[model samples]
Target: AELEIERWKNENAPPNLPELKEHLQTKKTAFVLQEKRLKRLRLLIDSNKFAEARSEISQWKKTGEDLSGLSEMILNLEHIEKSDDIVLDLKRGLAWQKYPDSYIQNLKMAVDRCKSIQSIPRKSFNWRIPSKDELLLFFTSNIESKVQYNSGSYWSSTTDKVWSDYNWIVESKSSSLVRTLKDDYKFVICVTDASSEMIYHYLDTLKF
Candidate 1:
């Protein structure tokens, strides 16, 4: 009777084993399909086909499919695309090179204020403006130097060295206002940090 009982148990276990193996196989297949879909979506995004990629994602969602890593991938791709688009727009606009007319006028006012001050000496000067390339070199070099010195937050804490080299002789001083001599120039060439509000002024002072 014990032998008969053992035989019955063996028969049931073997029959159930195939079903368990099949279930695991189905799960593996589903995972692979999801992975393939995710990879394709990524490729589309990289190719700059965001609309289609989004549409495909919507379709997947409608089908109640959960992509294992799709959400993170989509977010990353969107971020990259937005960053690239912004750079492209900035390059096209050349917004950094020329100050707006109002800003230029304000700078002129500052210069004029300096001229009105009696204590400042006005010297006739013909100074070379630094080029964009030169400014970039100076800005990068300064940041690098700060890093070398082991300064904390090289971008924020370091004084903008761009304008520091010039003889910032108070060109003029009114009752309470003073202006630097170089303020007359519409756009003084300097590497400006948009985030740090720091500029390396008078980069032209460098021998190079």
Candidate 2:
């Protein structure tokens, strides 16, 4: 639950990666399903059917569904992307994630959520907070038009050399990168390997 805001000097430190592909597969599948369920609940709330909405959620509780992410998802409904697609940018060799434990978090938490999705099979790719340059690739006019990406200021793993506590973030609105405190709350988009083999591996493992 604790997202670590990395010190500037430790920007290149290795991430905590999930070794079991099966675990990653199971977790990703459940998360995608839960997101679908929440979207339906979101529609109910939008329609102002408060009682009906609460009743639907009661069923989830009875079925032992994990509602730990419920509060954050429901409260931040507007900012969260509706698409559950795991996008692959072949040119960059990166596969992007649409969901996070919370859409908005401090730099540390955002990176932690990304690291949770990393899988190390025979051919490995680690997920972590993208660097400023990596994130810039997403903010481009051409890429923006093609990808179903989340729109907002996003924290980057790249940090300042001198400032030590400052980090870079991309503001989607202005399409610019700026320095800010590591503790600042911002959105996240996690990326991992999108190699040819990894692509097939992801679809087969996660059942895309």
Candidate 3:
């Protein structure tokens, strides 16, 4: 029967081999991503980190990512948290994950280490300081009252290539864009791809 099925597949093969190959490659790429997710889920389950696994599943659902077998996995585990609740917890986190490291110094170091958490949400947060433009927008936006940060300047991803010693920051008091030494102590908030409401909720509680 398997041999007959192979014969049937061969007979149905497209004449455009290049296009067929491209299609097959796309499927393979998707399959690889799915496999990684499954592996991560399994590891989480085995390690008994059910909340994190649920969080991952919720994040995927929020982003509309394909969750091929995740629902079944959750069922198998007897996880009682409703999908809505799981999503709510994630929303509470702002989907803005605080890195395990409380404080990190220097822009280069922050960039290098922050990439490690990409596997959590199955997407990279791309931990970066807000740009001057982004910071200005944040301050001027209607959510300004809700938006809060530490008492001093926080680093912005913007850098002065000409002046290698300085980096830009958003001043907390005036919301003015200014330059400062990267070596200074400044609170950091990683970026997130959370939903609009989640993002707004996050901006309200942002802290050092």
Order of all candidates by TM-score, from best down to worst? 2, 3, 1
CA shift of 129, model 1, Å = 28
Q: Name the lDDT value of residue 123 in candidate 1.
A: 25
Clashing pairs in model 1?
Answer: 114-172, 161-200, 162-200, 162-201, 163-200, 163-201
Residue pairs with clashing backbones, model 2: 3-108, 3-109, 4-108, 5-108
Candidate 2, residues 88-170: lDDT per residue as tens digits?
56577565664433458998888778777633221245677888998898777354565555678888899998898999999
Which portions of model 1 miss their true places by more than 4 Å?
Answer: 1-15, 61-85, 88-208
Would you list the clashing residue pairs of candidate 3? none
Q: Judging by lDDT, tell me the better candidate of 1 and 2.
A: 2
**Residue ranges of candidate 3 with Cα displaced over 4 Å:** 1-105, 108-125, 194-208
Weakest 10 consecutive residues of candidate 1 by summed lDDT: 195-204
Better TM-score candidate (2, 3) = 2
**lDDT value for model 2:** 0.61
Instruction: Compute the lDDT of residue 77 as modeled in candidate 2.
Output: 27
* Reference-based lDDT, each prediction: 0.34, 0.61, 0.51
The residue-by-residue lDDT of candidate 3 on 1-208, one tens digit each, is 3344446566875466556666767777776876676568667655657667667666542334344344333432333222221111233222232223455467666555555544333332233455666656555554334434445566677887788888887775787887788777666544433333322243234221
